[model samples]
Target: MIYSSEHFSISLLQPKDALQLNKLLVSNTERFIRFLPKTLEENTTLESTQYYIKRKIKSAKKRNEFVFIIHDKHSIDIIGMIILKNLDWKIKKGEFAYCIGKRFKGKGLMSKAIKATTNYVIEELGLETLQILSHKTNLSSVNTALGSGFEWQATLKDEFKPLNKAPLDMELFEFSRPDRF
Candidate 1:
């Protein structure tokens, strides 16, 4: 297990999780389309989801990115995903992106998962800096970053552009390995 909480367990996303992963995406279509358009496109069909999982596994093998699935503790149903992407090996920097099915929102799973995963990325993967980027209007995401100990860095202008929408400013929240003063 990569991490566990009272009601969920996180682990490397496996090829066998395609069906449930697709279901999670299908169920959250309305909620995820704005920011997670690309991800949603990947899971729009079971066959596509399977292919996506294979690609993700290969990417993880190359250390280009990492993907974890959040499963319900009881049934092991995939309910969410957390990914470490945009890796910069030269600088030991990476960015985090995550999403949960609408049915599982407001449950603190994301906040806890992000905190635990950040620790794993820094301690085990040797990354020095991790970033959580959110649109300024996303209060819940911003709060998740703050609650997980990320410090507000800056507002990146035109950092994100939702499909069919104007570009948006993104809030940059960073979590870096603390200095040993």
Candidate 2:
């Protein structure tokens, strides 16, 4: 799927995107560590990042999962990525995850990318619901969810624990079919 907004374009990730994706992932390590465990931080080598990209592309082809990279049309720089995974056709549901390069945050790029991705998933893929889970303390993530029309669902206490850190609460949010408008 390919989508374009005024500032960015959202398109299916390609195998050739591995190198750029790896660089972005590594550069944004600090931001990613906010949600992921420290072990993840330590394991984010270029090889591991390449492995992840390959897996995502493969899974997208096999399971109707869609992963897209956000890029500036002019510069063609990768700014972020969004993934719609774990698609359940029977229930028409899927989980959404996204991350923006630290340099691209606060520019409204995320909201635009999400809106474009959600539209494609709902209209093209026929998904009826989308779920987003984030750490409670990640205010930017929570705000992004709400901004994209996801409603507060519930909180799961001590749902995740980063290596050497205390367990953290997770907030669940959902955007139903009707919420698109």
Candidate 3:
């Protein structure tokens, strides 16, 4: 399903998005490589991006994960991606990860995506809690998570090992649906 607003839209990443996803990754490699090391390693080409998209689609069908790409409402250009992953059916919780192109930074696009996705997770998916983990130094990511209503949870020690860099700590943030009972 597609989610939209006046400025941008969100849709599931499909095989048709391979070329745009590849270009986005390549153009923002330096900025994203650290956060998306595994994804960058796997989807290095258009063919690989297509393969990745197919896998994600299968995961969504299985109710395991949902990945959405953020696009400009007018131009239809991909600006970022938001993923609801690590879903635990028993616990009613999921993990989130998001990234935006450097050119699209500081525009509040990701914050909107995160908030929209969180609502979908809670209302449509029936997930109670959504968690986000970001490198402590990534102020933009931290701010986006906070602005999206994810509260500070904890700091995980040596949570991420970026390429060619020392192990980094990650701050965990979480949002949970209010109790109805």
Computed on alpha carbons, the lDDT of every model, listed in order, comes to 0.89, 0.78, 0.88
Give the per-residue lDDT digits (tens) of candidate 1, residues 1-181. 7788788988888988999999999989999899999999888999999999999999999999899898998785788889899999999999999998877888787898888888888888999999999997888788888989999999999999999999999999999899722
TM-score order, best first, reads 1, 3, 2
TM-score of each: 0.96, 0.86, 0.94
* Residue 131 CA displacement from its true place in model 1, Å: 0.3
RMSD of 2: 2.8
Q: Which candidate number would show the highest TM-score if scored against the true structure?
A: 1
Error of 1 at 46 (Å): 0.4
Q: How do the residues 1-181 of candidate 3 rate in per-residue lDDT, one tens digit apiece?
A: 5678998888887878888888888888888887888878867998889899999999999999988898887775788898888899998999998889888899888999999888877998899989999987799999999999999999999888888999898999999897833
lDDT of 2 at 24: 75
- Which candidate achieves the best lDDT against the true structure? 1
Off by over 4 Å in 2: 36-47, 179-181
- Model 3 lDDT at residue 149: 94
The C-alpha local distance difference test score for the whole of candidate 3 amounts to 0.88
How should the candidates be ordered by lDDT, best one leading?
1, 3, 2
